[model samples]
Target: MATKNNVVAFQYPRLTKENYDKWSLIMKTVLGAQGFWENVEKGYTEHDVAVMLNQSQKEASQNERKKDKNALMVIHQGLDDDMFKKVANATSSKQAWDTLQKFFEGVSRVKKVRLQNLRGEFKKLEMLDKKSISDYFGRVLNIVNQMKRLGESMQDCRVVEKILHSVNSDFNHVVVVIEELNKDLESMTIDELSGSLQAHEQ
Candidate 1:
């Protein structure tokens, strides 16, 4: 276990394209533990003192302001120079978080277009005659995984079915046997089918 001092001094993981999900989750957890996540989620609203606040209300407002600043500084510390510049002018922690998200995730329009293109590529994929089974599976899985990462609702059975139809004619006999034996496509896993085909290849 880390000592109290070590835990307090812990550095957040840097954000990268590949690590966005993990990095954001850890950052949210850390900020929540520190009592600063509210600033990022709901934002800090400035109090107009035209109407006098009661003593307790004043204290609460001061605490909120402190939390917001702390949250902003922690976010800044975790960013590299380029990312830092993007959020430098943000007036609140929520604004900073939004800026970073937009920078990393791109606009919804772009994601939608990319998702459509990925779907097209997935539909058109075929196992080339010269490609090894592993290589062909890798190609198919690359597009499938990318689609999932981008928030597509791709099911495992859909992938399995695609593989059944996309393999080279060399595996036609095994494919037919597997399809005829397994009436329910969803009952067979990708690994089991791959292993059976590999054994036949050997």
Candidate 2:
């Protein structure tokens, strides 16, 4: 009997190409807090009519089904027509959730291709001449973050090494000093490396 507005007090943003990640996170958090996230993730299984269920079991099953319907309604209310159609045929909240992920989370094929392209960009990233240290770091961090969002595994050490190698020759002396001083490059954080580079640049 709970309406979508009554089930969720706050307005949940509709999912879009640019907002899918943020929207998905917020929706999951809200649903989880309401004890409906399991229905979305794993779905509710109907009890077999052939087996006689105790009164408590029957009541629990009915409650689970209600929760499933509510979860589906929450998802439906948050999507635009185009997005809604993606999961309109789903029989359960789990099916609807998986369908949405397939469409918006970039299917395996698309994600793989994107990951490759991002890796290439990361490899080609260099601190250009005349670019400030902060600007250069920002460029690198942008690529790193994009890679992370796409599920690529980027270690801090890998990023530190990449930045150290990519900076212009103006930073050659400092880079060498850092390499010598820090025998274990893996222990150096990006921020620490950036601070050292910024100091040299100034």
Candidate 3:
């Protein structure tokens, strides 16, 4: 645990074509720490700007709007000329943040490498012999989650099927029963599969 006094402050990394994956995380942390992330996450729409707010609501909106401008200023300062041009038309922090994310995330080299590595790990993942059902599930889910975080569009059914197909021979009966329950296991959630297997384990 880092004590407040011992913690060293980090400078937010400037966004570049190659560094968006890592920069985005740091930017989110900086914006969150400054209490400006809410506006960046949920910007006002055109309808919101057109509507009349009551006195209390107006005051609250004003405060939030100030936070938005502050967040935008930080983002603007963090960006280089080329990146700034990309978001020049954005009117709100959310718009700018989203524009940056959409433009860079798909093209990030680091993200691609990490995705490849995660995919390789997921492909080789299997429940080791003598590992408890929960332990094995934890390992499988860990790799799946990491892959998901790297933008893998993994569905619940795929995870269910992966778990069902990969467990040890000790679960041969349970696997067959689960497969029979749903030939495709289309609706089975990860938790649901874990529960059924754990019940059998007991």
Candidate 4:
């Protein structure tokens, strides 16, 4: 079995015809870690921002150039033939990155609309009669996870508040007491809330 990782890497999502948001967000982080994000964000030849590469990269040492190649290689690894073909003509890593950006510019709006729908679904979710706290949380997290996948910046406080508000009447007293005593809802985690609620149930 694979050993557990303490520092989990951001998953490198593959460039797909329909998933530009996920792919670009993760790929940008991976590239950023290697110091090539600057070149990609601001081209090598274009030096308005000369933080990474300067003046057509005339100032770039061989080591910096190699880093650029490594960044390009990683981008290629995450692409399929069709996607790669679009960036094939790009000489610099930035050129390749920009080509894909232009291709997926329309996806940003679609992601927002999908996230709006998820918000509605989450608000409508509730704990049903006879459902364990664990089970109810599972339902809540399903929608939460989907929103997160679409780049929603969901906070723990919001999730905790939603759970407390939507719990069955069986948990009404406990939810009231929890909200009253734990005024700092932002600091309360789902695990802490669930454990408290489950203890009350038992």
TM-score of 2: 0.54
C-alpha-based local distance difference test score of model 3: 0.84
What lDDT would candidate 4 get against the real structure?
Answer: 0.84
Best prediction by lDDT: 2
Give the clashing pairs for model 3.
none
Q: What is the per-residue lDDT of model 3 for residues 34-132, given as tens digits with 9 covering 90 to 100?
A: 998888998854337779889898888788778888998888877989999999998889999999887775676678899899888877778899889
Model 1 regions lying over 4 Å from their true place: 1-85, 91-107
Question: Root-mean-square deviation of each candidate, in angstroms?
Answer: 6.0, 8.5, 14.1, 10.8
Q: lDDT values of the candidates?
A: 0.87, 0.89, 0.84, 0.84
Q: Of the candidates numbered 1 and 4, which has the greater TM-score value?
A: 1
- Cα error of candidate 3 at position 41, Å: 29
User: How many clashes does the backbone of model 1 have?
Assistant: 0
TM for every model, in the order presented, reads 0.56, 0.54, 0.51, 0.55
Per-residue accuracy of model 2 over 80-177 as CA lDDT, tens digit each: 99888888898788888888887865665687798899999999999999999999999999989989987888899999999999999999999999
Off by over 4 Å in 4: 1-82, 86-102
Model 1, residue 198: distance off in Å is 1.6
lDDT tens digits, residues 110-196, model 1? Answer: 778999999999999999997888888889889999999878998778998999999999999999998998889898888887887
* Model 4, span 55-103: residue lDDT tens: 5565556556677777888889789999899999887788889888877
Candidate 1 similarity to native, TM-score:
0.56
